[model samples]
Target: MSTIAKEIESTMELNPGIPIKVLQDLIQKKYQVHISLKKIFRAKVLATKKVQSDFTTQYLLLRDYCAELLRSNRDTTVTIEVEREFNPTTESRQFKRIYICYGCLKVGFKQRGGEVLGLDGCFMKGPFPRQILTAVGVYGNNGIYPVAFAIVEAESSSSWTWFLQCLGNDLDLNIRSNFTFLSDRKKGIIPAIKKVYPSIEHRYCPRHIHENMKIKWRSNMFKNMLWKAGGQSVMDYSTMYDMAANGIEGGIPESWVDEVYWLSTWKKVNENTIDPINGKEMWTPSACPTSLLPPEHHTQIGRPKKARKKSVEELSQKINTGGKMTRKGKAVTCQVCKQKGHNKRGCKERGPSTSTQPTSQQQ
Candidate 1:
């Protein structure tokens, strides 16, 4: 036998449970051959199991060898696979029942003071550019968290209702009682919210209200009024009605009556107030009053209009084209006269007719 094998045999005989490390040292010393402790242990365990037919003794010996090997080679890796058997009928029923209960619980939770705010706008290109809807919430704690979302075409009242109803269904929200929604004063949003939660407190944001204000009153006076009204202590419907009738500073412009009408009727009840939990005041105009209704009572109006369109055509007309009407080409014909020979003003045909009927005396 090779010197290494003889050394291993002698080491095993001397100490039946010799640690793998000591066995390795003995083999190296006796045979001048180096071998890892892991190989030695594996070989010994396999040999013992084959020779020893007693199941209990073999199991105990293997367990002890494995424990010693693990201690000596702490960094060694081992892989294990697990298998389980289940009854198909029993598992299917349990899973389905759990899902149904979860859905019901979700609806109940949302119904109990979970307010949802939804907003959306169109994109530049898509099969249905107007179909996107994003939903968020103003939690009781006054923090915003996105809850549900969707995309769809058409922003009609019916379409909005369908979207909200579907969202409630998907989220398992208590669609009838749990939702209070705020959205732009688009024709569809109010009716949709009312249909779902008639008694739920739905208020608009003040930022949107000021935007509508700017559109109605281009003057600084209305801007100032918006600031003051926002700060008022009591923003009851009557107070808003009076403010709208008299204008922000009591100088109502004829052009802004319709805007004022909406403000009085549809503006959110709350304008500006500090959040009770966060202690952060809501957004308000610069001229908002110091003592006013609480933040929770205020609401906003329609979303602010987009910035006014700049007139590029008018701007081009005012620009100087470097005194060149046509670069490297014949002079252009006049569009009005459709003549190529001369410019419109310089055309002979365009001038007053030179021939005149003779007066009787001249004849």
Candidate 2:
């Protein structure tokens, strides 16, 4: 019994679990013991179930060691395989198909007519450290559809280029005509895309440009002005440009103007315009206000008014009467809704109550 416990502990140290059937099989094979497999399996199951109550201390130490090793070797891959003594064929088949489906779903495939590709990377957690996940999408019918993704490291220009090149090789995007590439203003993305597909129209997302604008201009007025400028049509560029330029003249910072100009120019180049500032000939909605795009895409053209507190008298009246004053200075109750002048709880439409008490004890 002590030998079996020691063996079980050693096996668990390596693999965490040994099914009762597996322990019984090992005992029979190695010791040539004559014991009913069913009885042995039941006894082992009961014993191990008991041990689980105290397994936390051992498991936590093992988990901590595994975590430390993972941190030390951030670039390593580990694969694990388990051999079960008793296999359930149906469950195994189901799990196999589920795994295959997971892979297929991760690598999305669809019928996108033309292959104008865009790529971006995000971080994820796994056995590997700093897993940079790359997403592949196509621009068609004026929309983007993500098709494939991969986990990678570092979002350097070289890393980005390699990822795209590998994708192109696998997907055969060379034949697509005038593929337009769009991404954030990452230093490497533009150069990488230019090198790989020179003919590809490279455009920086206006949303990213808008974010840069916010960083450049802390003032809400200037930020709003920039947004309006980015959304204006090409024909309206002069108007939008002058509006932005005038805004700078009217206390909008010069740095903000320069940032807007840079974004406008980038948008122009991406849209294949000869001159972005010419305003009259090349104006489009895409050329207008830069702030119209982004993390906050709403158009905020006017200055933000400071929120003022209600007058003391007004607040006092509100609390005392549950009434509000309209623009015309008329006080009204929301009492039916507890609004001014009416109480909803005492509305007359609910029928009169019935009397159940005797009338003054029949006096």
Clash counts for all predictions: 19, 34
lDDT of each: 0.46, 0.46
Q: Where does model 1 exceed 4 Å of error?
A: 1-118, 139-143, 170-179, 219-221, 224-363
Q: How well does each candidate superpose onto the true structure, as a TM-score?
A: 0.31, 0.33
Poorest 10 consecutive residues by lDDT, candidate 1: 92-101
Model 1 has an lDDT value of: 0.46
Local accuracy of candidate 1 as per-residue lDDT tens digits, 12-46:
44344556787677667866887877777776565
Per-residue lDDT for 1-363 in model 2, tens only? Answer: 545665555454433345667777777788898656666655555555545534433322332333343344342222111223265442221000000011221222222234345566654322122225354553322444444444334456766676666555545556343667667887767787777777668776665676677556656677577668767753433555777676744344333443323444334323421111222233232211111100111222235234444532344452433474334445555444545644455655545767898678665
lDDT of 2 at 77: 25
- Most TM-score-accurate candidate: 2
Poorly placed runs, candidate 2 (over 4 Å): 1-110, 114-116, 136-144, 175-177, 221-363
